[model samples]
Target: MYIKPLALLLAVFLASLRLAAQTAPAGHVVVTHLDSKLLHGNPGGENPRRRVSVYLPAGYEASPSQHYPVLYYLHGFTWNDSLIFNQDGMKTLLDQAIAAGQIRPLIVVVPDEQTRFGGSWYTNSATNGPWADFTARELIAFIDKQFRTLAKPGSRGLAGHSMGGGGTVRLALAYPGTWAAVYALSPAFLGPHPSYLPGPGVGPALRATSAAEAQRVHTTLAAVSLARAFSPNPKATPFGANFPGSLGADSLARRDAVLARWVLASPLYTLPIHPAALRQLRAFAFDWGAQDEVKHIPPTCRQFSNLLAVYGIQHTAEEYEGTHGSRIMGSTGRVYQQVLPFFNKHLDFSP
Candidate 1:
């Protein structure tokens, strides 16, 4: 029998992974599969049982009686809740930071919010389910009950990258009582930027012959994903969301309708509406890469930072030297230097 070359390689690779797991580090990465009631009846019929990645510091088990602060990390579009070994190992990175006293020993939680359309945007909508509610209520309650967490608003922080970064903004504005501090890295679609709307590449996704081509086509699926997240109309076409004539005519009226929905969902548009919520945050910070591949992101980041100033909100925003995904992870990245220090400076770490 002749096996495909890729299949043979995959089998060998998986076996190697199994061998490595046998010698896996003593670092704590709790794998908890949680079934959420909020996502139970999604229009997209996505699985409610989500696997969350939790990182507990070295001393967590030794000091069982002690409670620690929590930081919830949301991953970017098309990316799941993890960074692998070569990506500077999520557990190893934290262990090193704690060992160096760079930051306080704490628990970090990451949820699998990837959906059939690629991402949930960490927002509540009829198409993708109540993602925001699931995080703010169910996930938090479960973590608190199952771990020795400092379970309160003052002790919790929220952060994300790319789409996840935008989620930090959405969650802070909509559910300020859940986390005290928040940060975003290279957030997208800030204040209804039109550059993100779907283009012709989305139309070719259906006919894509190769996986790589399909992946390229899938980038444009953000149109479908964002529509499902923002202006979800269960009775509408295109995955039960009004994707502004995605498969139909791209008319001016249709584009306007879609843009209107985007504004309603944008943090920039909602910033004024939730002045009190933004002010209530113990700390708020976000940054972007000056050389971000996503051309509109750098400017949009500025737009958001400027808007924050206009509203008299106290927050920190900066532009660093890197690309959208370049400076996010590993030891020499924003996660290690900027994000962690920001949280440590703000989040309550008192025993």
Candidate 2:
């Protein structure tokens, strides 16, 4: 199993921003919530619907008629859903950056992607619940329908970090026509590890267990969750590692088979032949920290980058020094800048 390392340089940039946050000017923070009943699965009846935090660029509220390109920002694990509007001084930084000419006037939508575990691999799974569909189909559809968005693939951008980084890639693959650009920040690469642990697959299953046991099970089940989320097999159970429902030696064999499938789907592996898909992509890029403890990222990223080169997929991949947590703010800010500008360059935003 290979884990991608976080970048160290991004951490330094985030640290500097943290210090700057102490004395920042006021009245620049912006937060607005959209009632996502469209994503609630029911149009009527008072049920708890998801709320999306919309961060407008400077002069957005003042210029009501002006429409802006939309950037769908997926949150990594361990984030407060409410903080889609708050937390990490994100709104303030976005406001400041837009004001400072660091980025363009765009609509930023931050949606929570956290589940029972620290994060959702952002793949629709019978085991991991409805996150994949919620994000890929429901969330994106809802945002486009309600908002004054530049509703086109070229005008849309997708991005995330860690678990969300994996999600950004997964979703982009699932819906290649949905986004023109994607930015993965410190993406968690699930190398060629065979997913053997299991629980549920995808579909509704009720196997009640104690909360303590659930947590305990996660030790073995985390890989299963990642697999089920990323590469699902509804026929397999507990769940499928390679094939479905085998044990001991047979399961291991099946697991190896499944790992091959994962390698095929990985950006590092498949981008070489799918030049059309890669070409459809306006921008594809990712960055990691040099101090990142996870060692697999550099090789995996390089492999993916090299494959992109074979297909003539123009992209920017880099490694900077930073850890997992320290680089979120700056990396996020940079991604937003890159993502929006890519859309601006590709899309005819002349409405």
The lDDT, on a scale of 0 to 1, for candidate 2 is: 0.58
**Per-residue CA lDDT of candidate 1, range 37-106, in tens?**
8899887778999989888877788887899999998888887776532243667767666665567889
lDDT of 1: 0.80
* Candidate maximizing TM-score: 1
Q: Which segments of model 1 are wrong by more than 4 Å?
A: 1-26, 84-88, 198-216, 246-253
Instruction: Give each model's clash number.
Output: 0, 17
What's the lDDT for residue 117 in model 2? 40
Candidate 2 lands at a TM-score of: 0.71
Q: What ranges in model 2 sit over 4 Å off?
A: 1-49, 129-133, 193-211, 216-221, 231-254, 258-265, 270-273, 330-349
Q: Which ten residues in a row have the lowest lDDT in candidate 1?
A: 245-254
> How many residue pairs clash in model 2?
17
Question: CA lDDT of 213 in candidate 2?
Answer: 35
